[model samples]
Target: MKPAPFNYFAPESLKEAITLLERNHGTSKIIAGGQSLLPLMNMRLATPETLIDLRNIDGMKQIREVNGFLEIGAMVTHQRIMTSTLVQEKCPLLAEAAGHIAHRQVRNRGTIGGSVAHADPAAEFPTVVTALDADIKIEGPGGEHWLKPAEFFLGFMMTTLQPTDILTALRVPVSPPRCGWSVQELARKENFFAIAGAVCLLQLSQNRVVDVHLGIMGCSPAPLKPLQAEETIRGQELTDDLLAKVADLISEQVEPESDLHGTKAYRRAMAGVVTKRALKEAHHRASEGRQ
Candidate 1:
């Protein structure tokens, strides 16, 4: 099905885009890459009267190192991120996650900002960003504001962004030395949404865990931070006993819902299994310093 009739505007600048959004008020939606929005539009789930295309905006597609973070423009394609040497060196977790986002065609057209703005509960980028403590930048008539990943996602398919706000970019801090990271998901086929997924980031000092961040998706309304579980690992040796305890803590924290993918019991059980496996693999990688 085709999308319903709507007035399309390709703004040349961010200011013009914000002005157009303000002029349209509640009747507009921003289109970047259209990888997710177009499908919703075709299904008649979203029928905005005005569509603001942001493709022509300059300076919104850059990927560079700014300060201590890797700043990625909202329009940077997934494929570009997957192949970028800088991203691979600085944030290999993001590159690995981007490589698994759908097929080549979809990745070539999908933008990181678009995915984050959509705030799909099952998407890899959102979970990874949340685990890494990334921040998102937004611009509107009110000027710019930054939101941490935890606060950025309010609920499934919803965010703190106003209708008039356009996500400008995402800022992710560079991983520290000996930082362990891993992402694991269970899908019937490659690139499909996971039945259960986990992303783990572990900071180690002298073979002991200094900090732990674990983010889970596809099992909750938004990415689950599982802070209680993280606290169980912090300042610990991450020995076999501690790992088991950490996994048990994570299982208790998650209240997964039953759906077409699996039962609540299955999801809850797998969440623990996946978390344990991901943490172990990440710890091994960090110890070996493997690419």
Candidate 2:
């Protein structure tokens, strides 16, 4: 299959991009990295009358820290994040998650904003951003706006972005001291989509769980933060029984669909197992922080 005929535009500035999108209205699709959109277009799953490429737009490729938040431009690639010392310093969880995305080739071309905009339920960026409570920056004819990850990701391959909007950057809070994080995912192959995945951020104070965030992916319509599990673990010591209970609760909360790769029951079970492992690793890291 081949993509349908389309007009292509590579705007040099965000303002120009917005103007192009507004002029095209709903007939155009924004292309950054083209990792997801190109594949969809080739398969005839997506057919936009106009394709607006964002690569030529400057300033969108920057990564900086401001006011304790890491500001990552939309054009920043997964491989860049995986290797960035600043990302590793301020947002180690995001760095670890970026290392899990597909393969080296995909990571070399996949943009952070593209992954977030693509909003695959099992994608690493969405799960990590959701756990970190990151804010998405968008610009359109109407002006700029910010959205929480929950507001940005509507469902599988869906987002709240308007046709005329451009995602410019993401602002994520720096991981605080006493925080430990881990990303656990299960895929048949190293670079394949995960059947189930867990992103865990644990904060410990004097051997007691002070705060925790558990983001579950590959087992729901969108990344799920299991508040029940987080609440259950808070103020408690990291124990095997407690971890088991949290894992079971997370499994119950996820809404996995049965597919060729795995059944709903299988995904649910794997989600639990992954959640347990993530919690254990997170606890270990947190303990290391104390020592």
Which has the greatest TM-score? Answer: 2
Q: After TM-score superposition, what is the CA distance of residue 186 in candidate 1 from its true location, in Å?
A: 0.9
lDDT of each: 0.88, 0.91
Mind giving the per-residue lDDT tens digits that candidate 1 earns over 62-160? 999989899999999999999999998888889988987889999999999999999998898888888888989999998999999878888788888
Give lDDT: candidate 1, residue 218: 84
Residue pairs whose backbone atoms clash in candidate 1: none
Residue-level error in angstroms, candidate 2, position 134: 0.7
The clash count of every prediction, one per candidate, is 0, 0
Error of 2 at 89 (Å): 1.2
Report lDDT (Cα) of residue 277, candidate 1: 87
* Model 1 misplacement above 4 A: none
**Cα lDDT tens digits for candidate 2, 1-291:** 889899999988889999999899999999999999999999989999999999888898999999999999999999999999999888788999999998899899999999999999999998988877899999999899999988888888889999999888999888888788899999999858889999888889999989888888899999888888888999999898998888789888999999999999999999999999888898889889931
Number of clashing residue pairs, candidate 1: 0
- In model 1, the Cα lDDT at residue 35 comes to 93
**Cα-based RMSD of candidate 2:** 1.3
